[model samples]
Target chain A: MFNYLKPNNLLKIINKTQKFVFIIFLVIISIGLVEALILSPEDYKQSDSVRIMYVHVPAAWISLGIFSLIAVLSFGILVFKNKNLSLITKSLSPSGFVFNVIALVTGSIWGKPTWGTWWAWDARITSMLLLAFFYLMFLLSWRVTDDEKKAVKISSYIAIIGLINVPIIKFSVEWWSTLHQPSSVNIFTETSIHASMLLPLGIMTAAFALFSLLIFLMKYNTELIKIKNKGLDRL
Target chain B: MYGKKVKLRAIFILSIFFSLILIVFLVFKSLEENVVYFKSPTEIKDLTELTSKKIRVGGMVKEKSINVNQSEVNFVITDFKNELIVNYSGSVPNLFEEGKGVVAEGFLKDRNFFTAVKILAKHDENYMPPEVEEAIKESN
Candidate 1:
């Protein structure tokens, strides 16, 4: 069953669904924008500046989510010899790196008004910076070598090693006395964020997830085309 | 064959190097004093000995404690367990307010008073509309 999802089948599926994915992305993003900017009330303290959270938080979430997925897929690639997953981990990275940069940039912009500093060597901020470096090193591991076998092994190892920083980034605020506050959005317990704000945040996160999916489809299709051009029947 | 060996060696070395870095970071995390961005007023008071080095004392600015004279500002940061007086002459962050979270950065004058050079406003995790906040306040 898994064999049927060969590179050729992926190409066909990608071409058929690309436009629909794009349309859905656009529609969700539009709704997200309205909900985040207008419908959500201004924060009692931060006021209009709080609106920046709509983009910053979603971008951070998407970046972290994508990296976690890549790490898991890399683990399969190394241990189970699932070569097909390498293409996925490869294609997923550019959007992940882009969102990582977006999160950092937006966080910097948000910090200037709230924390009175554009940047700080705070624990959470530094760990996030380290994650970006990991993403960079993973992306570079592919280009630095032309041999696909070498590239896959090196990149997978990098992913597995970099995953140690993920939890550190998540808990940096609680572990240390950082400038950033504790997370309000809890999963196991009641969330501190109000329903009005969480609603927009959820929509924005969905839109961003769809957008990353669209990006992945295009990149995956291109990789498949490359394989087909080389007369390779399998990836 | 020689080139292949070199490439393999390079990959081996790189993996070891990255793994070592992660291990070092994990080991370093155990030592908390080196990493804290700021210390609460109570934590500062509990210290066995005070260092002359610059440190940030963080907590809530006690209500009615803010005294602004010209460019100088004085306030008391309390953790509800202990309080520290901070005197500084600086333009504070926009969010700085009485009864709000704050962090003062400067050298300590003594155990009870600090000579601050900068004031940063800190906020809680709670976020809501002004109206909603007012209503909650009224209901309370």
Candidate 2:
């Protein structure tokens, strides 16, 4: 299972599949944009502003999901002592942070017309802000350190510690009083969103996930090449 | 080759453990005050003092309670047992209407009055805000 993730082997796989991933990502995103912008019915109440959800919800979902993935990868490093796992965690951080920013900005844009405020100190909003802080700390661990090994170890720890915020972000609306509304799509129960709205949202989410993976592969490949070239300098 | 490296690893692990504890404590402490809970008109009426902290009031908009002017709109939020008047000076959400559930965020001026900075309607038609659901339930 873990064998495929070895740096050289993973680099070979990425080199082979990068084009396919990019093509699929482009196709899915184009279809999603069409469905979201043209096919879906305008919201009865929010009107065109509701279209923002097509981007905001998907970005928010990916950011939270990727952070959880980082936690799992961090644990894999502990169990297997694999440097590749640490490098992968580093590669995924920027994508997650990018999505986090998109979610916040889009949410604010949606909030202004609907919630009547650009921002609030609501539980959901605050926890997400905290998640962004954790992302910053993870990235800075790499930037501020000269020792590559020490930076990897410190970042892995930060990733693990940050896992606590994921569940909080998921349950904040249910647990506390917040300006943000509860989730529209529920995994176990029936979803409140209509199928027409759901289709574009699903497509957008798939596109974002594929795009993140594509970015991750490119980043991991670059990082691997840098390490391979520097192998002798460290010794 | 063995003892020094093992000792350093142990210290590194311990420091991370302590830092995690400190962060969790600080987060909860700050969140304790910032977390605002939803209160119905009945609940607001029960309160003896008008605190300065921001609060959210949720309930059905009273029938014919809305008074619109050039600058501001005033309405009453009711939970059957009690009602609190809310005044605001912004563009209300399109869904804001009489007999619909709405949540207003602002400060309480007195037992019966609220000056709202924002009025939030439901995010979707099928989804009612949980606070509004709870307020309706409590009212019944």
Candidate 3:
């Protein structure tokens, strides 16, 4: 069973998939950027500023999406006793952290002109902050633990525990009265969004998803290489 | 040794399972309410009808329109052609001033005044915050 699950075969598949996905990501991003910036109509009211949504909303979504993936992967490792799942979740951490930071920073920049302040303790903002803090705690824990396996186990637990906040962040606007507006896009209801606007949003979201997959593949490959090298050294 | 390893893995796995469940709960909860967009005075005027539902209003401070009392601050937000008078009772941003763009989040009780729960000032020409920018764009 272990022989059939050879790392080399998995690595080859991941690399090939990553390259293809990367090309798709770039194509979509270029189209999204051009459409969002040039072709999309300037909002009747916001004029040029509406373009920020092309970056802001997508980044926000990716940040949340990555964390959700990490939480699920972490849980799988802990419950199923799968080292591979733990490794994948660990590999996802840096990219997840980077995207979350981007989301928060970009959000603050967009908030200033509309909200009157750069920062607020509103439900949405505060919950995101908490998410960021959890990420930091996980990263710091890695540094503190000397045993690699111990670190992985502890971080996985932390990731799972922190998962509780994801909902609080998402629903912060609804559960409690918040200054942050509620979500515009939902699966069940038809959106009132204009085609021009929706096109760029869709494109950017695709780009972000592809970009995340590409990063995950690269990181996982690097970890695999490191593990192989260690095995060779022991031999 | 195998038992120790398994125990560690179990704890890690259980934590992740619980977290995933929490995330699903949060995402569903967040979907319950629609995020409201902020509209400027000019934008609002062109809209078909006004709903009593909560929304945000964004615009620039009208020159000389600010009236500040001990705790309350009243001002007018103008979007070139139209203006809405806003009454804010909370702390104001440092950059809040005449002629700068701002967003007030709350609801309109009547056509005359917007009672704001939060006031966000649009800072610097090139550097309006993301939330404010998104709000202004979406509402338009």
Best by TM-score: 1
Error of 2 at A7 (Å): 4.4
Tens digit per residue, CA lDDT, model 1, A57-153: 9999899999999988887676555667898999999999999999999999998899888887778899899999999999999899999999999
lDDT of 3 by residue, A161-193 (tens): 787878777767666545566666767766545
Residue-wise C-alpha lDDT for candidate 2, range B22-128, written one tens digit per residue: 88768776866457547789878887777899888988899999999998999999988899999998878877888877889899998988999988864533533
Clashing pairs in 1: none
lDDT per residue for candidate 1 within B64-128, as digits (tens), equals 99999998998999999999999999798989999988888899888899999888888778888
Off by over 4 Å in 1: A1-4, B1-26
Candidate 2 has an lDDT of 0.82
* Best-performing candidate as measured by DockQ: 1
Off by over 4 Å in 3: A1-4, A232-235, B1-118, B121-140
Residue A143 lDDT, candidate 1, scale 0-100? 91
